[model samples]
Structure formats: structure tokens, C-alpha cells
Target chain A: MELKGRAHKFGNDVNTDYIISGRHKFKTLDMNELAKYVMEDLDPDFYSKITSGDFIVAGSNFGCGSSREQAPQAIKCAGIGAVLAKSFARIFYRNAINIGLPVVECDTDAISAGDELAVDLSKGIIKNLTQGREIAVKPLPEVMITILNDGGLPAHFRKHGTFNL
Target chain B: MGKTIAEKILSRHSGTETYANEIAVAGLDFVMGQDGTSPLAIRAFNDMGGEKVFDSSKIAMVIDHSAPSPLEGVSALHKLMREFAADKGIKLYDIGCGVCHQLMPEQGHVVSGDLVIGADSHTCSYGAINVFSTGVGSTDLAAGMISGKLWFKVPETFKFQINGKLGRGVYSKDLILYLIGDVTADGATYMAAEYVGEAIDNLSVEARFTISNMAIEMGAKAGLMRADAKTEAWLKAHSDRVSQPVEADPDAVYAKVKEYDASRIGPQVARPHTVDNVSPIEEVEGTLIQQAMLGTCTNGRLEDLIIAAEIVRGKKISPDVRFIVAPSSRQVYLEAMNRGVIQALVEAGAAVVTPGCGPCVGTHNGVPSDGENVISTANRNFKGRMGNNRAFVYLGSPATVAASALNGKITDPRRYVR
Candidate 1:
């Protein structure tokens, strides 16, 4: 599968509280409602600044706090195509994939804010349209691809009646 | 071919000889979710066509994140968790039961060598007792609840060998904060942090819990320690289950190994906006604070409360500060009260709240106002962690928080510890 978007860049250690604050979680659990406040702490107008299918590009250890699914769910709900980072905290990595949000581990130094980019998941390649460069990323394990193809763990379970992987 | 504690446990559970970076599907010994994450897990469970949970006895749900429901929407989510727990015949820890991390071990749901999973990042706290436990998301928790099994990519281990003895004012909180500052937030990403050596061996069970609980802050999958006599004694006091500790092989491979002289470490603190932004007490001292918190899953045990009480005995806190204390559990509350810890704190101008995660997660019961500064014993000092994004949070030991409360500013606890 392939994804195309303009990158929304962030620095290293973009924690979950910064992704979506805990204050919002207490107020509501609705992903769409929470999506309105995604990255509001770091960028006050993040929700209004981007269109659907945009990408959130971050440095190492993205999503490095709380196990709130809302962090990934909010990104997905905000219609982000994927999150590309140098690395991810373990729980956040599992969460993004389990919820059908593609999280790619790639060197994001070549990509800047608002850079047009294309990611081919199966082929493990990232093409930076703005920089005219190509970078390699480690392809996700086969099970994760299967789960994503089935539209997340819930949908995968719905189709298979159990954990297929 | 030697294996670390994590590898051995995973291999035993998966019925395969697993190693680092290898994927294995293992049966879970226990599964847990708190109100913060359980509501979503329940929704995902239903969406996945889940009817009955696999082994209701092995499943637990907690309601500590926002106990007593600060809003109607949150109340509805709590209700959903309650009804789901009831319907599935799972153990439900209602409001005031305390944080899930403390309750799981206190209630005897965890044991060494068990593969446990929770929908809270601090679930790594169980690793203190030698369990190979880690956190997951709501959907992953739901999947584990439904199938009683989950997949894992065995993590490489990073071993921290600490020696010597800590100073009078220094505690495990300072040591862990020092480690975080050294490793940075992501240095141990996707790795199991094995904390062992003379310093760790000398720490109390409660102190070990504090160290393991913040493992997630360093991006570690789990923070583990080999079970010893102290662990056995603690397990015996907490539960009837027999201990099955796992240890790393002498020749076990490690991603990296770090050593420290605990005696040389001073009282440490993690400054605002990020946990890895650390400084010694001398650097951050005299910074004014509006609130001082002494409780959470990290350092809310009886030992912590006792230390705070000792520092504040016969002395009143600064009138400019709002000193809050919330025990991690009812058991801890009862023990503190029995030992006069609660009385000392209350007499010193502290407002002791219920036994749960009060003001730690920023849900309710002490949310700081805008631009305020808070020094807390809880882990994590990210922006908005105390419910207000504009507020600043500094993480420290309970003694430091208590001393700072007395002075209305960040102060060294050593002057008061004696």
C-alpha cells in the first residue's frame, strides 16, 4: 500500500500529551471531538492548518508518553495519512498500527514541513517530492501489513473471529 | 545463547525458545485496564464482536484516573466500564481503589515470571517483581481480553549496574531521574531495562516499584529486577501466590550496559515540559512553586508518605502553596494513617485527598491554574500533565516535594531529612 501527503513536521520526543493532551481525554472520548484539539498544545491551530491525508513527520521517539489510544486515534481521526518518524515508543507504535494508522520509521531529516511526499509501505521507500530525494525505510513485519490491510485489529478480529496473526 | 529475563519469560510463555527481536505469541497471565483506557477497550471489544471475555478471573478493570466522575461524559464512560466488568464477571476496582499499577500488585494479581499486560503505560511497574509486563493500547487490551493472548517482539535488554549507597536526601526517585537524564527519553526505546546491582539489591520493594514504574518515561518496554528475598517477602505479604522469579543469564547479551556510583548522585529533578530535562537540586532550587503533590502510582506508597511526614512534622507548609497528598491505594492510606503519617501531613497544611491518581493525570482534584508551577512526586512533567498546559511541572522525590511545600519554593530536602 502507498500513501501520499504533505508533511507536518515535529521535533524529537513528541509525547502523547503533546499529541493530544490528557485534559481533553477527561472532557470527551469521542475521537472526532478530540481530533479538533490534536497537537493544540504545540500548534494552537494545527487542526485548522492542515487538510485530510496530510502526514505528521516527527523525529525520534514520537508518541513517548501515556498509552492513551487517543494519541494515535486523534491523528487518524484528524485524517492524517501516516506518521513518519526516526523511531516510536513501543506502545505508540503498536497503537498506531493496531488502529490502522501507518507509522513508518524513516530518517525524516530530508523532509520538511509541508513537503510533498509519497510512502510505499510494501516496497519500504519514501519519495520526497519537494526535495527530489528517495530514502529507504525498513518494511513493517508481514503480520502488521495483514492487520493494516484488514483495517485494524478490530476489523481483523471481526473478519477472522480471532487474532489472525 | 544466554537469555535475559525478558527472553526467558517470553520463551516459557510462548512454548518456544525466543530471543531478542523475534516475535512470539504468548498467553497472558493477567490483563488490566483502568477507566482512562478501559472505556475505549470495551468499545473496541464490542466492535470486534466480543461477547464473553476469556477467563474473567484473570481480567481486572480500574476506575482511578477520574474517580467520582468530574463530568457527565466521563461519568458515562465509568458506567460503561462498571457495566462491562459486571457483565463479564471481572474484578472491578471502583473509585478510590487507587491507581491500577499499585492495585494490581497489592491485590495479588501479579507474580514474578508472569506475562502481564495492561492498557496503561505504567504497567511496566509489575516488572519490579520480575514480571515481564508491558503496556499496550485500548485495542490491544481488548484483543488480549478476548483471546487471552497477545504477540510480542522480544526486546533487547539494557542493563544498569548501580553500586555504592545513596545519600541521605537522595532516594530511588532521584536515581531514576538521573538515569533518565543520562539516557534521554528515547535512549532505551523498545528495550527492556534490567536494573540490578548493589544499589538495587539494597532498595526496599516500594523503592524498586518507583524505579520500574517510570521505565516507560525512558521509552523502555519494561524495567525489570531479579526477584530476591525482599521480593519474596513482599509477595508473601501482599498475596498467597508462590513466587517464580526469572533472572538473566551471566552471558546474556545486552544492547548497552551502563554503570553508576549511587553514592555520588545528588537529589535530582526533572524540569518542566519533558522528563528528561533534569537538573540537580542546586540548579533548580529556589524556583517558586504554587502546588506540591506527594502521591501517584510512582511514589505514593507508605514509605514515601512516611518520608514526607517526617520532613513536615511539627512544621506548617507555606501559606502560598497548596500541598496535596493522595495515597496510591486504600491499603497505603490505612498503613500511613496507622503510623501517623497522614496526621503529620494533615497538620502541616496538607489536603489529603482520596486514594487514587489525584492531580497526577490532571483529570481532577488539584488541577493547577495557568502559569502555575508544581513540584510533584508523580512521574512525568510534560506540558499540561497537571491538567493545564500553561502550568509548569517539576518532578522530584516526596521529601523534596514536602520540603518545597514547607518553603513555598523548590528547596533541598537534605536540610530537613535529618
Candidate 2:
């Protein structure tokens, strides 16, 4: 899948609470509405500008903190094609993959928004569509690849009844 | 040719002696969850063409978030889950039982060596009693609802050996907070921790639970210790099943070993926004506190209350502070009441609530207003987790939280020591 957009970069440990203050959960009824305020609390202009297919590239430990499922749901629902961080919090990583959100972990570099990038899961490469630059990331392992391609664990199971161990 | 207790449990429920840190696939034995993810997962389940669960007995749900629902959807989610469970013949618990993991063991649903998967990250809490537990995604949970199985990765084990008794004012929460400081946030990624020490054997199940519950903060697959007499006693009172224990063999191999001296420990707190940003309770003194909550699956046990009650027995909470104590279970609640500890707490101006993982999940009842500062006995105090983005949450022991409640600021427990 190709995602063409500016890359918005963040440092390591960009936690779930920073994306959406858990306190504001009271104000919003559903996750769809909540996605509008994603990352708005940390950066006020984040909600208005963030568009579809924009990759969120981070340094390390992206999506740290409470196991709030909304953290990933909001990000994926907002149409992020892939989240390529140096690393991910355990819960956030699982939550993203389970929700069918494309999340990859790659080496840290100077990839920023407006550098339109195309993510090739097959070739394990992230091509900067705008800058015409390309960076390679490790391909997803076979099992995880199955989960991602199948559109999350639930969908995968639905398509293929329990994979015999 | 060989296996540890965790390896044996994982293998039994997963791939046959498979790849390192990887599992092939297998059926699920138990699925557990709290209020945070169940509602939305059920919604997703319906949206995803998921009809019925594979089996009702294989699933268990609890309302630990928002014991009183600090907000609407979360509360409605709990109510919806209750109705759904009742409608589907699924076993469900409200604030009536306590936190998911607490009630899990209390209700005899999660036995030692059982493979339990939960929607909440802290589902690893079951590992303290030797269960091979892991946290799963909500959608995966929905799929597991209909299909009674899930996959897992074999986890490397990190063994923490403890020696010496804790010094005055230090407790298990402090020990975990200290470990976070030493190891950093991503220290134990994909690693299960097994505690082995004289101190570990001597501690109560509740204290051990506190340790295991926070394993995620260290990026661990799960934290655990061999079940001992303390676990047996706790199970006898809570579980109706014939008791069994899961312990590590004397020759079990571990990935890494870390050691700590308990006597050198002091009460510590995880500063806002990160569990690893730990500092001594004395260092953060005068950190203006607006709320002090003393309870959760992490620190809401009876011993935690006893420590809080002793601190607040005669002193009154500051008028400026909102102090809430939430026990983790009905049994803990009843136990606290029968011991006259409840009277001391109530007299000290603390509002007591039911047993569950309330407030800590950022649910209402103790949500701090904007610009407020919170000192809590719960886990995780990331920005905006309380009520407002401006609100600050500082994690501490019951002793620190209790003292902070009395003074309305982040005061160390040392000053309150008699």
C-alpha cells in the first residue's frame, strides 16, 4: 500500500495520553468523534491539519502509557497509513496491529512531514515520494505479516479458522 | 530438552516447544478484560460480522475502569457489558468483584499456570501467581470471543532476586517504582519477570500483585513469582477450586538476572508522563497536589489500606485536596471495614469507593481539573490522564498518597512518621 503525504515526526516516548488526554474521553461519545481531537491536546493545530495517509515517524517508545485502546483506534481511524517508530510501547503496538492499522518500526532518521512517502510492505521499503528518497525497514515477520495483511487478528481469524499449531 | 515454569505453561497452551520468542498458534483457555476496551470491542464485534462467542465460560469481563464511570460512554459501556453478559450467559462482574486481575484470581477463574489473555495491558497481573498471561488488542479480543483461541510469543525471562527486608516507609510500590528508575521504561520488552528472593517469599500476595501489575511499565511480557503459602492462603479464601501451585524448578534457566537490596530502598514516585521518571518522595516535596487517590488493582489491597489508615487515623485531609480510596475487591472492602480501618479513613475525610481499577484509567470520580496536581496510589500518571491535560499525576505508595492527602501537597511520608 502506498501512502502519499508529509511525514510528521515526533521524538521517543510520545505517549497515548499526549495524543488524546484520557480526561477528554468524557466529552466525546464515540471514537470517530474522538479522532478529531487526536494529538490536539499536545499540539493545538494538530487536528485541523493532519490528513489521510500521513505517516507518523518517531524516535523510540512511541505510544507509551495506559492500555487505552483509543490511542491506536484514534490514530488509525484518522487514516494514518503507517506508524514507523524506532520502537513502540507493547500495548500500543499490539493495539495498532489488531485494529488493522499499519505500524512499522524502523531506524530513526530525518524523515519529516511534507516528504511524501510510499510504504511498500512487500519490498520492506519506505520511499519518500516527494524527496525521491528511500529508506529500508525490516519486513514484518511471517506471523505478524499474516495478522497485518488479514486486517487485524479478528479479521484474520474470521477469514481462516484457527491456524493449526 | 528443558523448560522453565513459564515456558512449560506457554508451550502447553501454544506452539510445541517452538521458536524463541515466537508462537505458532493455539486455542485460548481464558479471556479476561476490564471496562476500558470491552464496550468498543463488542461494538467492533457486531460491526465485523462476529456473531457469538466460541464459549461463554472461556470469557470473563470486569468493570475496573470508572468504578463509577467518571464519564458517560465508559459508564454506558459498563452497563452495556453487564446487559450483554447477562443476555449471553457470559460471566461478568461489576465493581462488585474488584479489578479484573483481582477478581480473576478471587473468583477462581485464573488458576496458576493457566494461559490467560486480557484486553487490558495489566492482564499480566495474573502472572504473579504463575499464570502465563498476556495483554491483547480489543479486536483480537472480539475475534477470540467467537474463536476460543489466540497466539503468543515465547517470552524471555528476567529474574529479579531480592534480599533484605524493606526499610521503614518503603513498600512494594516503592520497589517497583525504583525498578522502573533503574531499568528505564522499555527495559524488559517482551520479557517475563520471575521474582526470586527472601523478600519476595516473605511478602503478601497483594504486594506481589503490585509488582506483577506494573511489569508492563518495564515493557515486560509479564511479571511473576512462584506461588507459595501466601498465594495458597489467598486462593483458599478467594477460590472455591481445589488448590494447586505452580513453581519454578530449582534448575530453571533465565534470560537475565538482576539483584536489589531492599534495605536501601525508600518510598519513590513515578513522575508525570512516564513511569521511569522516578524520584524520591522527598525530592518531589511541595509538588502542589490537588487530588490524592489511594486505591486500584495496583495498591488497593488490605495492607495498602492499613498503611493509609495508620497515616490518616487522626489527621484530616486538606480541604483543598480530594482524597478517594478505592479498594480492589469486595473482600478487601469488607476486610477493611471489619478491621475498623474504614472508620479511621472516613474520619480523615476520605471518600471510599468500591473495589476496582477506577480513577487510574482516567475515569471519573477522581479526575483532577485543569492545572490540578494529583498524587495517587494507582499506576501510570501520563499527561492528561487525570482530568485535564494541564493536570499532573504523580504516582506514589499509599503512605505517600495518604500523607499528600492530609497536607494537600506532595509531602513525603517521613514527616508523618510517628
Identify the candidate with maximal DockQ: 1
What is candidate 1's lDDT per residue for A1-165, written digit by digit as tens? 778889999999999989898888756678999999999889999999878888999999999999999999999999999999998898999999999899999999989899999888778889999999998896787788889889999999999878778
TM-score of chain A of 1: 0.95
Residue pairs in clash, model 1: none
Top model by TM-score, which number?
1
lDDT of 2 by residue, B1-418 (tens): 4566677777776657753466646567788766777876787677566767888987988876667565555667777889878876899887667888778877788777677788888888887887777777677677678777766667778888888888777888999899888988888876888878987777888788899899888888778888887787777777666634567667777788899998888889888777899998778888888789998878888899999999999888999988898888898899899999888999999998767655776656666778788888877887766656777889999999998899888887877766
| lDDT (C-alpha) at residue B365 in model 1 | 90
- TM-score per prediction, in order, is 0.99, 0.94
> Could you give me the TM-score of model 1 versus the true structure?
0.99
Off by over 4 Å in 1: none
Best by lDDT: 1
- What TM-score does the A-chain of candidate 2 achieve? 0.89
* DockQ, prediction 2: 0.55
Return the lDDT, model 2, position A72.
83
